[model samples]
Target: MTRIIQLSDPHIVPEGTLCYGVVDTGKALQQAVATINRNLPLWGKVDMVIVTGDITDFGTAEEYARFRSIMADLALPVRVVPGNHDLRENMRTAFQDQDWMPESGGINWSAEFSDFGLICLDTLVEGHHHGELQPDALAFLSDTLKNLGSKPVVVGMHHPPFNTGIIPMDINNLRDSAELSKIIESHPAEVRLVCGHVHRSVTRSFGKAIGLIAPGTSHTVTIDQRVENPHTLSLEPGAFMMHEWRDDGIVSHIIAGNYSDERHPFTTPV
Candidate 1:
């Protein structure tokens, strides 16, 4: 069984600096790393950790360095795609030594696991908050899925192709996703779409694929569902996701960062 952990939207800033002068994103990410490492034994042999996006708030070299430093404590390997807040070239330079880092063009890559396949696509449109799967990324998805054959696959991107009720965030979602939907719908095997831009856990169906949006590692985007609500962030508890390849298909679970140490048997419930 292959299990993959998903952490998203840490928005790490430089050392001693807080994101948006409010969220201590770097520290929050440290806590998340510690939590995951502490619970690894219970989770059992996680294959890898995938950060959906927004590794740095300003996409600076110092911020990337700090993000790397915090993640170094994690007892697992990690892969990432680019989010709107991330500068593509900067991110590429930071992880250039990694095998998955593409030398040129969009940061599109794929990995083949024992039971399934994983594909990460870059949807970053520089200088823009919204996301778009450019022609190159679309082509990469098509070719990679064709090669994977009947294996169930998880596709990771920074932006959700579908809109959530949060109006501000919804407006910045992945644009022109019809082609993307068509590709996933045409695939023979199961295709699960995992994303991270909105900083909220949202599950929706896109064509035949199940789309899951992971919550952030630090602060969360406010949950107001009004059509004209103010864009904001909340100091909600952080969390990450674990996706395991079971006999039937992939099963995803949310692991909270903050929890009490005490445990009680289910039979002891009032």
Candidate 2:
């Protein structure tokens, strides 16, 4: 079994100010790092840790420095790809040592795991919140799957391929979704798509694949169940997801940034 953790949309900035006005993203991320190191085994035997992007709020050198400082002690094999707020050059400079992190123009890439396949897709357009995978990304998707033959695959990217009923946010972004959806739909039972950017845990079914939108580790966007204007962020606890791959199936747990309240049982003759 492979234990994989997904941290996304940290949006760490250079000056340590809240990326927006409401959340201290750096603090939240630091707490999460502590939580993982103290509890999650990903700090030791995690097969892979994938950061789905938006690592920096401004894509500055200092921002990456702050990010690195917060996650200094984590020694896991981590992989990262670009997001709307990330700059390829700056990321390359910051994480040069992590050869698994995709490099510029190497956007659409694939790597193998002990029992499955991982396809990292780049969905960032040069300067936009609305994201779309380019033609090259589509070709990469097709070719990568062809080579894998029958291994269960996971598609990783920063943007969710389909809008999640958030009209305001949806209207403003998440472009070219069907370009990749068609690919997944045709792949039979061989693929799953995981994405970040929604800042909330959401699940959707697309053809034969399950599409999962992981929560942000920095903060969460308000999930107005009514799905009205979706431009607001809430003080919701920071969170992330752990994908547990078992021999029979893969399950994802959306973990909120809080220690377990379930207490251990201890008994004594009193």
Candidate 3:
């Protein structure tokens, strides 16, 4: 079995800095890291760790440095993609050692672990909050899927391919998504599309595949279906997603900091 931990929208800033002058993203990430380490014994093994996007509140060299510092404790292989809040060159330079990443062009990449393929598409539109899959990115996706035919794939991107109901976020969702859907529809094997940017967990269907939005590690957007603007952030518990790939199929579990009274640890095993 292959397991992957998906962390999204961490929004890590430079030391002593915060996001929006309110969120202590750095502290939030530290807590998240601790939780992951604490639960490692129970989860057994994790093949790799992938951060969908928005690695920093601002795409700065300092922020990336801070991000690397915090993530260094994971002690596992890590992969990443660019989000709307990210700058291509900075991200590429920050993770230059990742041989899978291309030196030029979009940050799209593909890697195989066991029988599963991890395909990451770059959906970043620098200087803009909305995302788009340009011709080049589309071609890359087509080629990657064609080459990996018949193998189950996990597609990672920064923006969701479907509307998330949160008006503020939906306004910045992936553009030209129909083209992406067509490609997924043409694929033979089962594909799972996992993404960030919604900052909340939401599920939808993408052609024959399932589109999953992982919650943010720092904070989450308030879910107000009736409101015209869904820009408000909440102090809700942080969370992440774990995707388990087995011979039968892929199962996704959303793990949050919140657990009920029955979930508390005991000194003696019952």
Candidate 4:
């Protein structure tokens, strides 16, 4: 089985208040890490870790450094793409060894692990929180899929390519998503397309394939059935996704830190 761990929308803040709101990002994220480490089933099989984007509160160099420091304990292989909140120059400067990072200032990349392909897309459009794959990126994806047709493929990004009717969020979806969906639908060989930035867990159909939105490690956006202007910020447990790929298919799980009643070793009868 091929194991892929996904950590997204961490929104690691600098040294003060939360990003754009009133969430306890630092504390929530800490809980998220603990949750993943403890809840992951078959932990020994985890092979690769992919961080979709929004690694920092802002696209600052120092924030990346702090983010890296916080991730030091994972000791697993990881790759990243930029989010709307990220800066390409600063990200490159801080994470120079991430070979998958695109040259030419794009930061998109494709990688291989255990005979499976991991495609990281650059969705940051410089000045917008909404993401769209440009012509070059679309071409890159088509070519990559054509060349590695039979491999189990996992694509990660910072934006959901579909509309969820959450007025504020859907307005910021991937621009040419219909075309992209058709491309993915025609390819039955692909396993899954995973993304972040929505701060929620959802599954949508893309032709014959599945698109997954992993939860954020920092905060969450509530779901409202009457969501006309539906934009809300609330504290949810931090979460990360674990995907295990075998001959049967890809089995995925989301692990988080907020276990309501799991007793820690240090917790006595108190």
Model number with the top TM-score:
1
Tell me how many clashing residue pairs each candidate has.
0, 0, 0, 2
Give the TM-score ranking, best first: 1, 3, 2, 4
Best by lDDT: 1
On residues 68-179, what C-alpha lDDT tens digit does candidate 3 reach at each position?
Answer: 8898988788889989889999999988987977999999988877767888889999999999988888898899889887888899999998897788888899988989
Candidate 2's error at 23, in angstroms? 1.4
TM-score of each: 0.97, 0.89, 0.93, 0.88
**Per-candidate local distance difference test:** 0.91, 0.78, 0.88, 0.77
Backbone clash pairs in model 4 (N, Cα, C under 3 Å; residues 3+ apart or in different chains), count = 2
Q: lDDT of candidate 4? A: 0.77
Worst 10 residues of 1 by lDDT: 257-266
Model 1 per-residue lDDT tens digits across residues 154-247: 9999999998999999999999999999899878999989999988799999999999999999899999998779899999988889998988
78-151 per-residue lDDT for model 2 (tens digits): 67777889887888888877755555564666788776788888887767887788888888998888788777
Positional deviation of residue 169's Cα in model 4 after best superposition, in angstroms: 0.5
Best of the two (1, 3) by lDDT: 1
lDDT of 2: 0.78
Sum up the clashes in candidate 3.
0
Tell me the spans in candidate 3 whose CA falls farther than 4 Å from its real position: 257-270
